[model samples]
Target: MDEEYDVIVLGTGLKECILSGLLSVDGLKVLHMDRNDYYGGESTSLSLVQLWKRFRSNDKPPELLGSSREYNVDMIPKFMMANGTLVRVLIRTGVTKYLNFKAVDGSFVYNNGKIYKVPATDVEALKSTLMGLFEKRRARKFFIYVQDYEDDDPKSHEGLDLNKVTTRDVISKYGLEDNTVDFIGHALALHRDDSYLDEPAIYTVKRMKLYAESLARFQGGSPYIYPLYGLGELPQGFARLSAVYGGTYMLNKPECKVEFDTDGKAYGVTSEGETAKCKKVVCDPSYLPDKVKKVGRVARAICIMSHPIPNTNDSHSVQIILPQKQLGRRSDMYVFCCSYAHNVAPKGKYIAFVSTEAETDHPETELKPGIDLLGPVDETFFDIYDRYEPANHDEHDNCFISTSYDPTTHFESTVQDVISMYKKITGKELDLSVDLSAASAAGEDA
Candidate 1:
C-alpha cells in the first residue's frame, strides 16, 4: 500500500481502462481500482436478471422472454466504426485478439416519415430513393468528388477549399436538396445535430471519407461492427492488456477516495484504510463529482423483441439515425438493434435501444419517435442519466476525469474523449495509426 505508482485510475469504465492500458504500455506503473466488482462501471452489460433487478425491482421476467443468462444487454450501447480510431486502438494494443466482431447489417436514416438506407458509395447514391433523378446525379457527382479527394491533391479540390468553406456551402455547390443535406450531415457524417453544417467543410469531408472507407472495408450493408457477446468485452480486453503490462487492478474496493495534496493536486487513492500513492490520478466523473459539471441528460429505452426493426431490410443488427429536422427536435435520435445473430440475445430474440439527448422530463414520451419504429417489443425499460464533463484542467491538479457517455450510439465521440484525456495525462497525442486493412481481416477471421 505504501508503493507509489505513476498513475491511479479510479474506474473500470471503457475510457479509464483504455487509458490504463495505454499508460501501462508506455512503461508507467498504474494502479486501477473500481468500487464495483466488475470490469465495466457505468457501461457494464447486464444479464436478464440483473436488468430486471435494476429496473423492475423484485418482479421476475416472464418465461416467454427467454432464459435470463442468454441475454447480455448493454447499459451504454454503442457500435464501433469499422475503420475508426477505436478499432485502430484495439488492433494497435493487440486487444482484438481477445474479442470477436460481427459487421452491423444496416445503416438507415429517417426522413419524411420513412427510413431509408444511407448510401455510402456513388452506385448506391444513384439508386437511392432519398433523392430525385437530377438530385441523384448531383449527389453521385458529389460522392465521386469526395471519394477522389485527397488533402494533398490540388486537382481533387474541385475548385472549392474545404478548409475555408462550411459544410452547407459544399452541399449547396452540388445543388443537393435540404433532405439530402440532412442525411449527409447526420447519418453519413455521424454528426449529432445540424451544428456541423456551420463548421469547416474539411471536418465533414474527412468524416464522409472515413464512412465510405469503412463501408468499403467490409463491403457490408453498414460501416459499423459490434462484438459477439456485447460491448462488455471491450473494457475487460483493455484491462487484460493493462495487466499484461504490469498494471494492477483492484475490484470491489469500498470508498475509493482520491487523496489530494494541500496544493489541490491529486496524489493517490485511499480504500479500505490503505493508501496507494501516485503522481497523478485518472477517473470517471462519478469518482469526483465536484470536479465535473452536468452538461445535459440522455434519455434511453431498452427493448426486447422477437423480430428485427421493421423496414430495415430485415437486418438482425442495424443503426438508424433520425435526423433532428425530421423529428422536429434539437438533437438526433438513434435506434440500435442487435439480435441473436450477434450473440447478445437468445435464438429468436433481439435487443433494441432508442436513445437521444433528453429534451423533456418524460423519457418515454421523448423517445417515442424512435420507439414507435420498433414493430413490437416484449418488454421495455426507460431511463435517463446525466451527462458530465471535467470542469478542472489536468495540468493544474493532476486529476484527469473522463466525461460521461453521450446518447450517440457510435464510438467516434467516445474515442475522441479518450484521446483528449490521453493527451492531457501523458502530454502526448495518442498515435492511432494502424493497418486498418489487416485489422479488418483479423476481425473477419474472428
Candidate 2:
C-alpha cells in the first residue's frame, strides 16, 4: 500500500493556509480544500481594483522587525494614544502596501470642502477630537476592569459578563457624549454585529485599548497603516503563497453535505455529491461542534459598480449612512460606506461593498420590501461621486453583484451587508462575485 499521508487539512482559511503552508514546506504532503470557490476565509480579497485610488495616498508603514522568522512576514509599527494612554501596533500580519490606514490623530474636521488638521499629541488635543464618550466619566471603571480581565486569549472577551451587555446600555449608564458614543458605535458596527444598539461597554473599551496598543507598537506617531495595493491584495498574496506550496485550492464548490463514520467521527465531505475522504480535518470549532449541530446563522451581500457618486469625500475611507430609528428600519440597520484601499478599482473606475445580516430561517422575510439592495446599486455610485473634488477624478462602469448566506455563524454576510449599504449610497458595484458555503466537521482547530 502507498504510504499514508502525513496530514489532511480541511478549509483554506488563512489559518489553514498558514498551517498547511508551514507543514507542506516542512515536507508533509498536505491536501487543502474549502467548500467555497475562493480562499482566505474571513481575510479574503475582491477585484477589479478601482476603489482604493480615491482616498489612499500610497503610504507605507514604518519598518519593524516581526516575531515570525519562519515566514518572511514584513510588518509596520503603529502608535495609538487614547485617553492619555499610549499603545503600539506591532505586527499587522496581512496588510496591503498601497492602501494607507491610520488611527485618527489630533483633530481632523471636514468644513468648507477642506480638511482641517489640528496638531497635538496630548490628551487635550485628543479630547478635542478623539475623545471617549463612556471612558471619560468611567475611566477608572474601564481601566480597573481590563487589568482584571484575561489578556491571553484574543477571544477571551466572550468569557466576561461585559460581553453580554449592549452598546446602548453602556452609553446611557455612563452618560457618554453623543459624538463619542456615535464614533464607537460605528466602529463596533465595523467589527462585530451591529444588530443591537446596546452592547457590552467592556468590549468597547477593550477594543479601543487593543487598537491603541497596536498603534503604540509603531514608530510613526500616527497609529494606522495603509495598504500599498487594495486591501484584497494582502489576503490574495497569502492565498497565492499557499498555492505555491502545493496546497489544493477549490472555489465555488459550495459544500452541501458532510459524512461521518458510524463511530460519530467525521470522515468525509461532499460538494455537489462528489465525495472525498479525509483523515484529519481542521475547521473553526464553533462552526460545527458536533454531528447534530449542522445549522447556523450567517448573512452577506456584494454591490459593485463603475461610477462615482456625489457628496462623497475622497479622503474618507469608511463612510457611515444611517436612517433614523424612526425611519422604521431596525435601529441595528445602518449603512456603512467602506472606501476601497489602493488599487481596489482600475483607472477611472471604483467599486464599493455592502454587508448585512439576514436572520436564518427567514431569508426572504428577513429582507424587507422596496429595498432593492442588489440591482439598483448604481444610484449609490453617483451620490458619493459628486461629493469629492479631485483634479484627476473620473467615473468608471458598473460591474456585478453577489451574495452569500451561511447557516453557520459566518461573518462574511455581515461584511456584505456593509458593502451593500455603501452601494446604496454610492451606486457602485464590485468586480468579482463569490459565495460562502460551509460543512460540518469533527474535532477541529481554529
Decoy 2 TM-score against native: 0.46
lDDT of 2 by residue, 1-446 (tens): 12233444445543345445444444555555566666555444433221122123343211221111111111110111321111011011121221233322121222222222221222423343234444454533433444345656556454445667775765566565554444444332223334446555565656555434433433333233333333333335445544566655566667534455775554555667666665544443222333123232333223343433233334322222232221233322222222323334333333333323333344334333212322235322111110111111012101111122222111223334434422432345522221101000100000
Measured over all alpha carbons after superposition, the RMSD of each candidate to the real structure, in angstroms, is 0.9, 16.4
Off by over 4 Å in 2: 1-7, 10-29, 34-174, 177-182, 188-201, 213-236, 240-259, 268-277, 283-312, 319-341, 359-446
lDDT of each: 0.93, 0.35
lDDT of 1 by residue, 1-446 (tens): 77999999999999999999999999999999999998899999999999999999999999998889889999999999898999999998999889999999999999998999999779999999988899899999999999999999999998889999999889888889899899999999999988898999999999999999888788789999899999999999999999999999999999999998899988889999999999999999999999999999999999999998999989999999999999999999999999889888999999999999999999988999999999888999999999999999788799999999999999999999999989988889899888787677767833
Per TM-score, the best of the predicted structures is 1
User: Cα lDDT of model 2 overall?
Assistant: 0.35
Task: Report lDDT (Cα) of residue 150, candidate 2.
Answer: 67
In candidate 2, clashing pairs total 95
The RMSD (Cα, Å) of candidate 1 is 0.9
